[model samples]
Target chain A: MLKLRQGQAAIALVCVVLGFMLAVQFRTAQDIRSSIPFQRIEDLSQRLSQTEKERDVLLKQVYELRQTTGAESATKESENIKMGAGVVAVRGTGLSITIDDSKRLSKPGENPNLYLIHDEDMLKVINELWAAGAEAISINGQRLIATSEVRCAGPTLSVNNTRYSPPYEILVIGEPQTLENSLKMRGGVIETLQFWGIQVSLKKQDIVDVPAYKGAFRFEYAKPIKDGGK
Target chain B: MALPLVGLIIGISLGVFFPLTIPVEYAKFMSVALLASLDSVFGGLRAGAEEKFDNTVFITGFFTNALMAAGLVYIGEGLGIDLYYVALLAFGLRIFQNLAIIRRYFLRK
Candidate 1:
């Protein structure tokens, strides 16, 4: 009887180990799925389109009202400036930074793929630029929003709808000096990228027009729950 | 002596089975529900086991630990953190509780 009980105990221990392992695997799978970026960008794009339409209609109404009332021209001009600042498309003062793989790091004996920039490298740059207070950013013409997913799609990184090869060029529109200084700030993005043998360049122009964000932001599959229960 | 052990086996089996179909978010909630149900069922088993069955104190101790599991799940969901951490907590606590029960049973004999 003691031998039988001991055998049962051993089987029970095996079950516990297997059960714990299965739970770990399931949790990891769920975490990776949640980290994917595409869904967030899609949601942000929808919001941008909605805000733009609302602003346009309101501006037209303000103009019509001013014309009939013959109010001070200063008031109209001020309104225009404020509205322009709010939804005004910016044109001028932009800097572009390009990242490419380092050729020096590659050799005949070692991996020839040494020059490729991984996803995390790009993410770091993007995060730094945002911290520098960049008003708008684009990667190869794909506009980035708050929810944009910057991830590796195979060999290329896809931002919004566009994908590009090595030597990714990221463009930002904001105050020229501030944007340039932001990139060059200590720790600093430029110094860090150079260490990795990635190319970093900053060019500031007077007429840099950051385009209004164009994307669809809607979540069809996700629903918020009050209390998490089965 | 055997009934409570069978109850535990049955409980753990249900834990493994119920989480298969649900999303990770709901699987977390179900984990808490399963532990709570196990506690209640074990309570009934302890009443019957009386003399031969042991480790009643350790089994009941699992209830206090269940709250910690439930708390971790709530914090994870509230913060939009991945559900894996919550699963980690639940599995860890269950294993600890099991060990405590086993230790009590063996030491008493």
Candidate 2:
């Protein structure tokens, strides 16, 4: 009985050791990796820039109401209504990228062969979306944050701990023309993915509303470790 | 297992006597194995002797590895030695520790 107890204790100890070592290693490594500009600052700056954009639809509506209403008593009332509705949160328009497995569109040396999306590919799209100045972005309804990490587990891509499969629809609500052009412009992501035989497409929508970040933005016990310079 | 133990001893000796001769890169990688093994063997011993392994000890072991790595880097900067080289020294020590565990406890299984 004593010997058996000792054996079990040894196994438990190994688990604890492995878990502790790996957790610390991962935490510190992630810190150093994120501190680099390519990871943290760039994404934050992009999100900030997107948030600060304000479209003065109210101003335009007021101008039109004034010209049409003429010198009427209700003209002021009409202007007020226009102003209220005009400030109704301006949303951007753009193409939504739906990445999925091309199980049906199989060819020579191409995508969907594994019937899955790789983490690197997801990273590419995320990076491109930021570059395109996407106002708001989400993947399958999960709002992305600065610390969000896309990691691969077997065939699935785990975003912030939630596993997602192919046909990963990335919705970006931004200026229709600018967003579409950004995705399809020369030397752009579409072309790069095209080479890999991955499907690339774009479509203009009347209104593309990308939702605000929904997940908790809680970060515990981690802060920037000095400026560290670029 | 014996060869790894011998390597660990050599690493410790070189670090103590002709520290400058040892390449920092090699030492850093070696440290990972050493530290990992030390973590494992001690873990097993604790389990064998004590009814349960202490969480505090395991956490501290991890913290020690991290501090050593970071401290070594800072020290290297001050001494005009490559920070990476200092990391290698820690790694070398870890390798020795790991070898000791593997030869005594791990291989016996």
Which candidate should be chosen as best, given DockQ against the real structure? 2
Q: What is the TM-score of chain B in candidate 1?
A: 0.40
List, residue by residue over A1-230, the lDDT tens digit for candidate 1.
11123233333333343344345445545644663464356436645764796699889878777676556666876766643433344555678778877754443355655456777888888877775556677777666765677888888887775677877877777666766765664345665666545677767777655554567656799777869856
Worst 10 residues of 1 chain A by lDDT: A1-10
Give candidate 2 regions above 4 Å deviation. Answer: A1-91, A104-116, A223-230, B1-109
Worst 10 residues of 2 chain A by lDDT: A82-91
Model 2: colliding residue pairs: A93-A174, A100-A167, B27-B88, B28-B88, B30-B91, B31-B91, B31-B92, B34-B94, B34-B95, B35-B94
Tell me what fraction of the real C-alpha contacts between chains A and B each candidate also makes.
0.00, 0.06
Q: Give me the candidate number with maximum TM-score.
A: 1
Per-residue CA lDDT of model 2 for A113-157, tens digit only, reads 443457776787778777766656667765565566788877777
Over B19-100, each residue of candidate 1 has an lDDT whose tens digit, in order, gives 5444343555556644543443333333322333334443444445455656767666545565546656556665566546
Candidate 2, residue A158: how far the Cα is off, in Å:
1.7
The CAPRI class of candidate 2 is incorrect
